[model samples]
Target: MAQDDTPSAFRLPDPAVVSRTMADVAERGQRIVQDFLKRQSDNASNGGGTGGAGSDPLNLAGAFMEMTTRLMSNPARLMQAQIGFWQDYMTLWQHTARRMMGKETGAVISEDPKDKRFKDDAWRDNEIFDFIKQSYLLSARYFQTAAASAEGLDEKSAQKVDFYTRQFVDALSPTNFALTNPEVLRRTAETGGENLLKGLSNLLGDLERGKGSLQISMVDRSKFSVGENIAVTPGSVVYQNELMQLVQYNPSTEKVLKRPLLILPPWINKFYILDLRPKNSFIRWAVEQGHTVFVCSWVNPDESLAEKGFDDYMQLGPYAALEAIEKATGEKNINAIGYCLGGTLLAATLAHMAAKRDTRIKSATFFTTMVDFEEAGELSVFIDEEQLQALEDKMNKRGFLEGSEMAGTFNMLRANDLIWSFVVNNYLLGQEPFPFDLLYWNSDSTRMPAKMHSFYLRRMYQQNDLIKPGAVDLLGVKLDLRKIKLPTYILSTREDHIAPWQSTYRATQIYGGPIRFVLAASGHIAGVANPPASGKYSHWVSDTAPPTAEAWLEGATELAGSWWPDWHRWVSALDKAQVPARTPGDGALAVIEPAPGSYVKVMASD
Candidate 1:
């Protein structure tokens, strides 16, 4: 993993949550509300057709609706979405920490039997442990806020509140403090000086080898960048696109697959994750089973190309990528697979292009993509106007947003796993760190231009209008998911900490299309990297009519093996039959080199 000295932008201010301050503010606001209600009487009659704030039920209902309308319109509230995430994250972590430390669990760290990354130095590092602690502490403060809400009451009420409050604080204090604090540095036996380690004897060996995986800026490859090599199946032939972009090699069989498959990798991470490795890579299994595959490698954003925004991505990213696929393979449309933010972007692109009557994209495969914000989980707490303003203000100064900020925001989302875990393992435990591929890739983050970041936050998480028709405007055009009307495949892990599965499942409700929603086992990364080798890895597939996820869960029997093969089968069913292969571009669009394009090299961090 590339070494990053960058501190988190969402770093909690000193004295993370001020109990007295928050309590006082809550009381002051409450008092004002009380005064208003006390002074105002039920004088105005709603039946009189007066739109004023009357005391009638109808007027009260209208008032509530108005509040909802204003809340939606208010930029501050939208930004507050980000704030709420932290507040909630803190609370959940506090409770979960207690639960985790409690007895009901099997293994804190899941055992990945077939995962090779776990063999070398894959043990828990201080960083991961520290992240756990810090994340819990951060969540504990939110508990305080919630408890403070019911104040100035009797001794029992106060005692109940205080009991919970003190329990959380006490849980976190000396003992709890250790949970949140991830120590990254350690003392070396030889040097006798404090240094960083993670039980990574290999890292130490690599340090001795003098070729450790530290990324260096080369004038040849210098720009904000991050990179990782995922394990693709041995026999899989990964290829590049018209723009010289890296794509998994999906060879054509004499008998074309029943379901044509296309993997949609988020531009944020390298596309090879779909083809990560033989044991886990999804592409390898798909290709072996005679499925046609295409994956997109997003270009790393740079200052030179900061002008590109979400709309530009539609025109160039997935839109252009799909167009290239159709021309190259002579297929009218392909089954598209997307992961994380890429899924969100892919869904939006499909919507925007569909509105324009673009038919090249048929079925969509969304891996952990969400279109609704109503229950956006911990992510919403940070989506308030103030944060957006803070972020936008920063973006306005710079043409593009740094990958660090995006990575930071995401890391904060799972502070325990992403941020503090490394801190504790590396800093506190005095142990050498594990070098898991997914973790290594996770540490490799990419930056977004300010324009794109601001637009995404405002439009998607803030407005949440893209899921509906004519709700979002991309490149001066309206984006509607319904217009696409393509068969959509939405897959989210049951345990995904970043893009919650339930949130991703909402995609079915938003679009009136033939949708297949699958619940996979594992977190965001592990879910997509499903290979036949993972014995425990299973997915729920419902061949019957589309039903509620719960019903699908019940009716959809667990497959004996990996979800990747099942996805390929599902997609192959959607793809057109054998067609002439397209070499590259038609007309004056121009044919470029095979892919692994210039932009695609972008690692998530600089």
Candidate 2:
């Protein structure tokens, strides 16, 4: 008997099950809509009508308008772009038609190998999905090219246009939507529309958590706590102040380097990023390496801390920690390390101490820090006059910048990874985010004091004044980077979006002291938090300093494994006098509390 020449029917979800799921999804969606409307109503009654600071806070419209004017002026160029877009689509259509006819045809366009959005086999093997993928890619390229090619606009405006254009394009990716995404479609079919219902529930939960705004949950927050699973290194809070609490870890070795290590982490996030877990904890590793490690855990500021300024952070933070360290260890000289914003502050404090003839801090190390903000990376797109004024207005009203707002800005830097990935996992695919220590710490953002944040943005980012001698005044002392003469080590990540390695490398030219610059392989957090045991990212080291970052990289030697050992060797070489290990409260500064102190435990929502 001849085989039946009939096409098999597609597997469809049960109508009753789909109906029930659709009803539940509709109910959840309706609640979300109701909550959003109520929020808008409350805002309107409170004299907030989506105007002034509320609308166009980033001044995105102005940049896009300028780009549009520039593009309109060159009609021939615009027409040429339109023609090119159609030509690509035509090629894609031809390729897709051949694919449907069982002909082996090359793709009209392909995604970057790093692009994970189209990693599913169906995106390549299925003709319809392949066409959809290429169409999106082609359009994304067209939009980005147009934005980059905008003429007559200033550098800042051009950057804004390009950056936001990419964000818009990324948002419109087929993978972010349920109907367009093959993975989501497959999951939906397998679950019989249950995934859509769950997705709606997740969407509602996120909306409710954000109080009408969408705050996509990036990790399972229930799985981790600050002082419990993560940040579990044994230590005590030796010193506390309004701005920060200095935690002095109990030494792991019998003897430690005489010069204790004080770490000043950025106040924008908690210090536990360095102490996430024992294996990857920089704090734990440092203590094991025979160094008395002390870290400053910054407070999550509120309206009450509104008056605090950058000067207060410097004096009450690292400076206060310095005096306390002296009383604790009975040592006048010490070594210091700072990460990101903290590193910038450390550089300034070094200058302040230089003028006062205070030589307590013998060595300094900066992790992805930028003293010179001339090329401050994509973050500069948010630092223009209009946006600053708008941001100041918002902060002035609340006495501090909301942690969520700052988090959103940072997320925009790597939207595909930080923002869209969560959107797909938690909303589109109806899957809960994996339990991740780094993302948990990332979600636990800290508010910035209005005065301090304003001073930082205006001085460092907008005006680019930190690099100039006497450009910044702190506690009656002019902060000149040139005056900071301590032996310095600057570690910059090659893929750092927040602090470009080249921008951070400019510090080598400014400081009077001998400098060693090292470039590590991943982005900001992963590169810095890498452990030797993990054997993950590689780093580059060079003894000589070149005028340009590119030249420095050209002569640098690529080495395998983490840069932590290299750093330990360099810091230890500074002053390797050994002393008997001292416990947290063994010295004059008594223990106030346990490690990962109360300050870090305070959530932004709280």
Candidate 3:
């Protein structure tokens, strides 16, 4: 075919459109700056300190300084690494040159197949973009390797250096920038710079919404509401207090499990993660399985609840809910399920109850919980003395740690998935985020009371005291995990960044009970929220609790579906007797509100 003189589709953007877009971006940029400055001024006037000494709250400087010193002491190794990086670049250059000559050449560096950033065809098919991608991958690998190879630093500092290094590398990925990203370029060509303009607008809107911080919209917040769509399980609030509301879901079966089921979700997030929709709602699924479910809907606490400690959470959370469940179900004996931080609290509560000779909890189930924080995983990077002190200073001023702050930390744990993907979509691509129920729930964060969060950080994360017999005291009772002899089901996710399966496995040895450890096949939320009907992920189960997590895994059986059914089987065996289904307000406790209740509906900003 004869080459036509028609301009290539990827030619220079329309000059007029480009000029208008830049002008609009400049105007929005000014607004963003002014808004940020105003927020800073307001915060300062309200006693929130100007970004000063505590700005490096993660103590990144100190960690990197130590790493730098160690690296500098080994000049030969550093030189060798630099030489290796240059060699890799040279090889990549040669590969690109060969490809330019229509010679097939293998990639010098390839990204993981699972990496979504470079999924666009142009990233690989277009030789120039492929070269750019390979160069970035090579550089990223070099930085990561160097960071990981850093010597002489403590384990915590080393981990901090490595984790932040990955963050830095991820941030600098070619895909993150519109100029380097092929898909964004294609979109720009198609839209005459409209995407870029819309992206700037979205960026400005997000900044405004976040009150100066860049809160990338993960989902279209307008698409969903608490009771209307997401957390729409059929239930009623049987009881409530200042800290929590006990939601007793209406049973779907004529005969339900004799022992009622109570779920204590992490107060760091809303309870509705387990009740996001009817299809995946664990509460709804449990109700369908002939078990009366009661969930502790924790209040999105603010300054008023700053004085509330871990003890208060236990009292108003599980303890209060237990009493309410007994009143509502006429059953003193009940099974309890705790998720993440809620599981941590439940473990402590069980120990406290064990100490007090209380046997109300006949069975216990922990979903990705950490009783022993020795190998607390990446989250430990944020719990050093300097960082915790800095965080406490901020919390002391505000009477509570801001929910977004906590949410940001969790987002960092999976920054590529939770943070940067949305950044690319909402800011770079100028596309509105899809209405994802999970992301919506993820965005609906909750605040942490000063005392409770502080105590949790110090005693559990920093000191790893929860496992120590008398290290942590709750309700005047020194917690001892071994004292809790209730039949336990420990469900840990294989890929849990928040609660490492290995870290959670430590509980098997800690608990003095008949322990059944099941490993689910996803991260924190998906693994636990997985319904049997979804058939999305597999699970592993081992009857024996070996001394080590590795040993347990070696002997485990890989099951084909959700661990919910496995959990049901285990929990059901504990108490096989069935009682007539009970309504929420039919017993001693009267209905306070609807299933999700008012507390969950309260936003952190509210």
Candidate 4:
């Protein structure tokens, strides 16, 4: 069969990502299911699915029957795997805790004992022996409950429910939960004991063989090699923009932007997620539309930068970016666009600059941004006192939060979808994971400075005071978002986990400026980076008065395509013009790479 000359009928370059993804799940799950079923088959090979005879013998038989049924159903072996894992995990946990106390400085390298975010810690500072105690208690409870319930019921029925319910209880035992929890009291509790003796010791007795672990795979690189359009010269809207090396990609266009543009992205992630490959970049589209866009690309922070708190970001990140734009364009105020954490930062900047009486940034646009922190949702589960203390202790020692720690927290929010989903596809399925460009990008992670994180959690999560007037103390300066009197546009996604949609809507009430609110289709990245013609995605109405998102969605109109193009229209009205396109930059960038920049190169990193 001749392959079509046009884009393949698959629509995507690779075979359908979704179908392969589903198959990966089914196939991968088959193994664990197979393993559990084997165990069940042992118990019930000759026995009936139902138990035989009276109380004593019948109870035993029914218990056997339930195990066989669970096995025969071919249910996943994750629980079994998770169970065995916890056993080994508890053993290691105890050993690690004991050895941790022997460290040179005695730092312990542990999480705050009070948080209880990870473990079944009924009290602060979990004791290692609690593992044994809790495990016994759990098993006892299961036995007691089952024995009692089975006493009054028909022998067979009682046995099955009791046996199955016991399995569920055993799965929830203390040893299981504690070991799997990421919030280990101490990092130094790592299982590795470095020495030739330790390695050789394990070699002799333990029956160990390497098994291919299940995990999600990375996406393939772009096959369609298309160069970017980045021509910088005069007769453009960004003409006479100042060129500054302190700032990146500075172009001296000989004129100030009558309509200046500013972009905001979250620090937890790299900036270029929005400025992704040229085909789907929001920044690239804005530049093509004759609007001047200034984007902030924050440098990943290291331990040395831990002392640099939220104030520095306000001053150097958005505030500095705005200043640079103003100096380059010679404009007093520029339009702002923020995505995710950057959106949160922008909202803060609006509040801060307004408090300082600096009104340089006007016409703000938020992409999936949130200002209200009252109901932070399930993600808040990891931020209680115990977890916070443990985090603080660890952060104090390291000075900066590890990227993996932050990534792990977000992963727990959707273990089935984000974490286990990948586990099923890549490692277990035995097939190279389908390479979707988006997942590849999502896998690319970043780091956060310790100080900034603490400030964010305290000011935003614990206080919920930033949205209220005069709450945050950024270098002793109070930030009130309501003071920022610029025209604002807030955007939120329907399926966002990080910044829930309704949280973004709360911005309407917080801001004193006139606002146009948009509800986009898809999750965080899909909603913002969404190009005009990806698939069937929809968004809610663009509202003005009575800024409630609910009331607006009900009364307001629906737009068929992207919030990007419509946003471009709404924003242009703030700084409208019929002028011709301007030069790309100050004619300084001799080699114009693509708009997405180097950050977006989605390689298959294991």
Cα lDDT tens digits for candidate 4, 314-367 = 777676666555555556677788777777778787777777787777688888
Ranking by TM-score: 3, 2, 1, 4
TM-score of each: 0.62, 0.96, 0.96, 0.59
For model 4, the superposed segments whose C-alpha errors exceed 4 Å read 1-257, 544-549, 578-606
Q: What is the per-residue lDDT of model 1 for residues 5-109, given as tens digits with 9 covering 90 to 100?
A: 344212222342344435544554455556544434331232333233222321223323443454455557445655885665665455455555752322222
lDDT of each: 0.55, 0.91, 0.89, 0.56
Our model 3 lands, by Cα RMSD against the true structure, at 2.3
| Number of the candidate with higher lDDT, 2 or 3 | 2
Name the candidate, 1 or 4, with the larger lDDT value: 4
Model 4 lDDT, full chain set:
0.56
Per-residue lDDT, model 4, residue 85, is 49
Q: Report how far residue 254 has shifted in candidate 2, in Å.
A: 0.6
Worst 10 residues of 3 by lDDT: 3-12
Q: Candidate 2 has which clashing residue pairs, if any?
A: none
Q: State residue 33's C-alpha deviation in candidate 4, in Å.
A: 27
Off by over 4 Å in 2: 1-47
